[model samples]
Target: MPQFAELRRRVIQGGEAHFITSLTRCVRWAQRGGKSNAYFAKTRDDRFIIKSLNKAEKASFLRFAPAYFEHMVKMLSGQRTCLAKLLGVFTVTFKPTAGGGLSAATGSSSGPNEGLDLLVMENSFYGRP
Candidate 1:
């Protein structure tokens, strides 16, 4: 997570996100229907989306982080690309629910799961030219 954070900082400083905000202040809304019955939401500013990831997706993101970072560097240098900017990768721990099973939509579990894998990216609704 820290590595990704550092990469994000470098890329943003390199000017890949001149239009991007600090993401320090925003609102969140819960939505439904995503991979592995995960949860999804958009920030109030419409600049970013926070989504839950299943184990496979989490693994894939970590596996591809190096390539993704490289691609962002290339794009930053004016190579032209279409990849979504990955802002952050994180985990949200949830306490077990009374039922002892994870909720398919919210990723909250009734004492059965430890946390939700999360991915944060630039919202597709904004920043297109």
Candidate 2:
């Protein structure tokens, strides 16, 4: 996956309202009326906190979350007035870790295969009425 520094730089340059990491596997209860999964991550300065969503409940989100995030970012930056806005989407790619003794040297893909979709948003935390 991209280093944390790289991701941070992208987020800042993108000028998104918020950077989110999906905590789909962490929290118990759903926020936003179970509309999306949950997530927790630090801000630009590394102050950490928690947020929740219901993303896993929908297949579309799983497939196209990245595209959706990017769309939102463009819309928001344009200063368009809409009921809802999106910021941007970022895909974090990571190198597979090595496992086993010889296999590790062989560069096998047996280690952790993990990735995440970063969904940027503007005014999403303001809550909806």
Candidate 3:
């Protein structure tokens, strides 16, 4: 967890991801495609992906987050890697508005993503053809 802010700055700057929004977004991913069953959402700007994570998945990441950060420092320090360039490792929640169900989230009546845990990462396919 040391130098986290600096590391984040470097990663974002290196990736030229300054256009990424800083708001607390309740996203609705446009193109949701993955092999897993977890709910996925994309940032409004289409620069990032939000993936719902179960307790197991969350625990798994936390267990390795430190080492991952170390690797990230090395990568940013010049030992480039093919691994994911994580912008953040945090939780997400979709609190319902007073209007009721988040039908706008999926164009349906289901509230599957409500009250779930999530993590945000830079979209690897961003700006790709």
Candidate 4:
């Protein structure tokens, strides 16, 4: 499996994610809207999508993650047509490196900062764009 560091590097290198080792599928850019950016990834096993929250809006999401997940579960349960589901909620932290670049970290930092929060979701091919 590719570690978070590797994934971060790929993202930073301008490589739009084409695959996710954890999900084990080829990912493609599906759609993006609102304050957060979204993408759809498809595979024979199942279609998945990932939503990356904007850095500026992390605080709002962090505050309501639990409530949002609960509501989603209720609304999406037992829906066969729904190819995507909520897998997990995690925080992707980024820090400014000494070289003036950014590094993707897994937790919050204590020093002065420049980082982002990302919300990952499985893509549902309900209405492919």
Q: After the best TM-score superposition of candidate 3, give how far the Cα of residue 49 lies from its true spot, in angstroms.
A: 0.9
- lDDT, model 1: 0.68
* Candidate 1 least-lDDT 10 residues: 13-22
Instruction: Estimate the TM-score of every prediction.
Output: 0.64, 0.33, 0.64, 0.43
Q: Give the range where candidate 3 is weakest over 10 consecutive residues by summed lDDT.
A: 102-111
> Best to worst by lDDT, what's the order?
1, 3, 4, 2
Every candidate's lDDT: 0.68, 0.41, 0.64, 0.49
Per-residue alpha-carbon lDDT of candidate 1 for residues 67-126, written as tens digits (9 for 90 to 100): 888887787788887777888877766665567754443653334557777788877657
The candidate with the higher lDDT, 1 or 4, is 1
Q: After TM-score superposition, what is the CA distance of residue 31 in candidate 1 from its true location, in Å?
A: 6.9
Error of 2 at 66 (Å): 14
**lDDT tens digits by residue: candidate 3, 44-129:** 65666777788888889889888888898788788978886665655544546568744234334334555466676767876788
Maximum-lDDT candidate: 1
Q: Which stretches of candidate 3 lie over 4 Å from their true place?
A: 1-4, 13-27, 30-35, 93-115
Model 4, runs deviating above 4 Å: 1-20, 23-46, 55-84, 106-110, 126-129
